[model samples]
Target: MNAAPADQIRLLDVQAFDVRLQQLAHRRKSLPEHTEIQSLTKDLTQMRDLLVAAQTEESDCAREQTKAEQDVDQVRTRAARDQQRLDSGAVTSPKDLAGLQHEITSLAKRQGDLEDVVLEVMERRESAQERVAELTERVSSVQAKADDAVARRDAACEELDGEAASVAKEREVVAGVVPADLIALYDKLRAQQGGIGAAKLYQRTCQGCRQELAITELAEIRSAAPDTVVRCENCRRILVRTSESGL
Candidate 1:
């Protein structure tokens, strides 16, 4: 609204700066590292769950092995006492000798069964231990990858932050030169048009929509007072014409 020719051109710089800032922000959000970090975070959670399950299984196996060992020791102790009694030959009655012999045979069978169970428990314990080890290693690997992804994401954000900061400074400097009403209009339009309020008019084409202007529209735009702000017919974006526009 009533901006001088030079002022209108300067407003283009402000619009350009805003557009660049928007692009930078979009790039920051869409970085490949961001997606990768998200995926890695999910994987880390799964790995942690697997590690916990493996550790629990390992603990259960250890407990079973301990109980099996205790059973073996108890059976062995009973068998030793029985052997001592048999060797001493203290039993004189035939019935008593037969009972002792039968008791010894039952004890021997129990000892063999307990030994086999103990061996099986030991094997299961070993397998459980191996699973725990594998899970530990896998969790560590996922953690390392997640850490790397975080670092990469941080670096990318830092770069974008720096670029946005510089552009913000430039935008502020340009804002001081543009009229308040024009800036207000640009801000409102930017909010409505997805952060792009202005486009360069090149060879009668609206850069925003990449569409050619009608002959009558082009003539009116070219003949209009330089101080008047023009909106593209196709895209409704503020058209800033320059020498490079070939208009």
Candidate 2:
């Protein structure tokens, strides 16, 4: 691997841009808004389940209340007819009169019992309605939160995407200055080296592997030509040299 001295130095800028791209990708994935949206979505699902259950219970309670009221109405209607007959003097015979009075008393009691049941059912239905209302409000609240999180996440994504696009365009220009073969080698090495294809040789250390170069390794590099491609002996990564290399 060999390149013009200037191309090798230019490759450093290419590598810097690549590192920046990786960092941007990592930041996008780890954004707090992304996490918040996920959590909010999960909460929304749970809230939906709870809301469905509450609605079902409320409906059932409403139906029960209606039935209870219907029963009360039926009993009261029968009692009203009995009282009408008694008041009309349709039972003049003493035995008939006594029987009519007794029947009226029984009907009144039945109506009262039915009314009590209606009241109880009404109370239960009211409670169920309250529960439904509460759950509905909660669902709305959680949905709003989820929506806000999504909006924030999207805004951040758009900003990052714009920056990434700009950086990618710059990379294309940087890549153009570097030799094709050298770029190919860097790409291949990056694939095998955990995304780090190049690093600087600074202070007698291979930054790629963070390993110090021994005297013999330093002597070899010193003897090499400036345009000759150099590799870190430890990590086999292209080691770009600069004035700060502390040769």
Candidate 3:
């Protein structure tokens, strides 16, 4: 496609701008904060799971403790009834009295056992509660860190977006000066070559692919008409040569 010499020169600026924009976009997506936030979020999830497990265990221990205390109360009530019967001399038979006394002793022993179990359950509940507290704190800390990371990532993205917007506006202005056919060809080549369509020719070398061109090819391109748009022989990208290109 035909493009004025000035427009062809401006293609180099467009190429540089596109490269910068691409780099900025990549940096925004791959920021360290982004990765850190993901890692922290995973940790928060695991901590929450641990806290849930601890709470479940604590609740179970509380229920068990309540049942154990109830068992002790029941046993004490039976012992009191046996004592009252003994005091009233309701059991006249010696053997029956002996059996009643034995029952009282067994109830006392059972009550003691239940009390011991209740104590153990209380201790276990305390431990589980402590674990839950620790895990809860950990989750909160991780969440705060994750929030900060997200904020930082967002700020970085916003800055890059602003810069990109400015560059885009400049590119649009430059595009208006180039021919429609040239812009279409550049767009097509960019899509096919990882968003890089134009490159400067430096000292007989195609900067896009870093391949040296033959002397004859270089002379032909250098002597081409002012409206002719040259392309790299190796990479097929628009070749925008300049005095600084040493071509």
Candidate 4:
């Protein structure tokens, strides 16, 4: 396939735009914020799980403390009733009075033990609450970081998309001027060759593969017509000749 010299040069412009678009796409994918967000998301998941566990523990502790306090209250009430009975002359028999006093003493001990249980439960609940608070703060902090990373990633993508849009439009316009056959061939070669369908023959080297054309290759290229589409033997990419192409 052959295209005019100017058309071939325009193909280079098209290639440049394509290269820029490729770079923009790569930059968008490889944004540092992407990795940062990923890592932060993992941390956030772990933190959220821990927060949930802590909250569950706190809730359980709260219920336990309530139950313990209720037990203490019940024991205290029983002890108070027994003491009242003992102080009054309700038990007229001396043996009955002694039994009542003994019963009161046992109730007092039971109340004290229940109260100690309440205190222990209170301490555990307090610890659980502190853990919940700490976990909550950590979750919030990680969530904030994740949010920030997401924002940054979005902003970067927006910027890159805008630039890519502009470049793509320009590529469309530039490619419009080239011959359909040449464009088709270039597209096919580009797909086959790592995004580069055409390259400049600078000095004596094929820019696509960075290989210097052999003497015979240069001789043939030098003899080819100006409008002839020549491909580099080394890379099989269209070699656009310029004045600097040291024939």
Which candidate ranks first by TM-score, i.e. highest?
4
Q: How high is the lDDT of residue 134 in model 2?
A: 89
TM-score of 2: 0.93
Q: Which stretches of model 4 miss by more than 4 angstroms? A: none
Q: What's the CA RMSD for each of the models?
A: 1.9, 1.7, 1.6, 1.4
TM-score, each model?
A: 0.91, 0.93, 0.94, 0.95
lDDT of 1: 0.86
lDDT tens digits by residue: candidate 4, 1-247: 7789999999999999989989999999999998999999999899888888888888988898888888888878887887888777687898988888888888888888888888888888888889889988988898998999999999999999999999999999999999999999999999999999999999999999999999999999999999999999988999999999998
Residue-level lDDT of model 2, residues 110-158, one tens digit each, is 8788888878878877887888898889989989998988888889888
The local distance difference test score of each candidate is 0.86, 0.87, 0.88, 0.91
Candidate ranking (lDDT, best to worst): 4, 3, 2, 1
Candidate 3: where is the Cα deviation over 4 Å? Answer: 245-247
Candidate 1 per-residue lDDT, tens place, 11-114, comes to: 77888898889899999999998888889889889888888887888898889888988998998899889888988988878998898889889989998999
Candidate 1: minimum summed lDDT over ten consecutive residues — where? 1-10
Instruction: Judging by TM-score, tell me the better candidate of 1 and 2.
Output: 2
lDDT of 2 at 129: 84
For all candidates, the clash counts are: 0, 0, 0, 0
